[model samples]
Target: MRRSMWRVMGLFSKKRQQSPSGSTSGQSCAATSTTSAYELQEKDLGRLHRAAAHGNLAWLRRWHWWLKRVSINRRDKEKRTPLHLACANGHADVVSFLVQENCQLNLTDNFKRSPLMKAVQCQQEKCVAILLEHGADPNLADADGNTALHLAVLSPNTAVAGLLLEHNANIDAQNQEGYTPLNLAVSKHHKEMVEFLQKKGADGHAQDQRERTALMVATFAEDMNAIQLLLWHGADSLIGI
Candidate 1:
């Protein structure tokens, strides 16, 4: 997909360089050179992205001027900003620096995954805390409509889930499949996750697009422990019967 996008841009660049006189012979060479340079620049990571991905705070601070040229929030071809990389890689200090510099907190990547989502998905607890403290939206959904809380339940990280809930993440946020975090936890047989989400007040009775509740999912999976937990928490036992 990335290659195709670059190819299209190259064609457009050539077309744009066509002179009003409709003579492309002279401009052909210049257009080729320009397109190649643009592609190289886009393919290569800027200094800021490199530092953030590697957790090199010293390098970033020292070459801060270069960062200004590239823009602290400059996105790659994938539309992922340096802040996204920092959180995904668990660079708490880098995440802190970027947030303090007033980087956009709620920006989503090509997949619509926010920095907070990446932090939770990657199990970067410190990074998650930093992004949440800096006002990252825990409710932002990805292309699949999975929020940070959704990802947290998939990982079954109670620590991260706790932080998101404390920051007011929507416990019942549903994904594109209409499955809430509790539904996902039960389906994945994440006993601890189901317990944690229930404690946080997730709607155990919440149904998916298929009208299947967490209790139904547990029954389908034949997870006795999950079914026991769900029933203990007042999940309707006969919803899908």
Candidate 2:
């Protein structure tokens, strides 16, 4: 039995080595492996959900007849639909197809995160644009009250941030903790994000649950560039510690 366990472990180790990180192709392979593992472990995930998660467009097409039997908006135990999975895995093609099928654009998962939030969290730029164009509500916060804009800033993806801004995502939308996207960017010492958000008119004076403004958060990090950027954006130095 010990030898059999060792063999099983060795097989997993071999599979892990086959997919190294860094390259885009490698990351896609890793995401596919992760979805496959999830499908194997979770009986709640249906075949269509698994196909969408894996970005298996061909499989989806072949299962067209089966599509009618299953609701496109069907949620698993996690309350995640096929659209959520496709967005989370950065499968732009799958996402486009799902949208074309008229799946609900703003359906939230168990976490209250919409497909747009999932796309931002996964740094899926193309998926983000697609969902936004389909009228996904950018202001919908997750269970933690973090909006798509908040996730985009947290990702520090300038392109995604710009896209969200273009879609009129609430620039000063606060989370459950009262931490706005600008506040988050400043706290994380994301200088370019801070600057970009400021250019987009994010409130530099927005405070968090602790009443700490972006400038105060910048002071805590001792980030000179962030401090200067906030000051340039009119962050009041006297308000926060």
CA RMSD of each candidate after superposition: 18.5, 15.9
Candidate 2's C-alpha runs over 4 A off are 1-43, 236-241
Error of 2 at 235 (Å): 2.5
**What are the per-residue Cα lDDT tens digits for candidate 1 across 1-241?**
3443233334333434542422221121111111100112424677677778888999988887776676788888778888988888889999998887788988888878788888887889999898888788888878777788878877779999999999999999888777888888877778899888888788988887767677656654556677777767766433522
- Model 2, 95-175: lDDT tens digits are 999898889999888778788888888889999999999899899977777788888777779899899889989999888
User: What TM-score does structure 1 among the candidates reach?
Assistant: 0.79
Residue 128 alpha-carbon offset, candidate 2, angstroms: 0.7
Ten-residue region with minimum lDDT total, candidate 2: 27-36
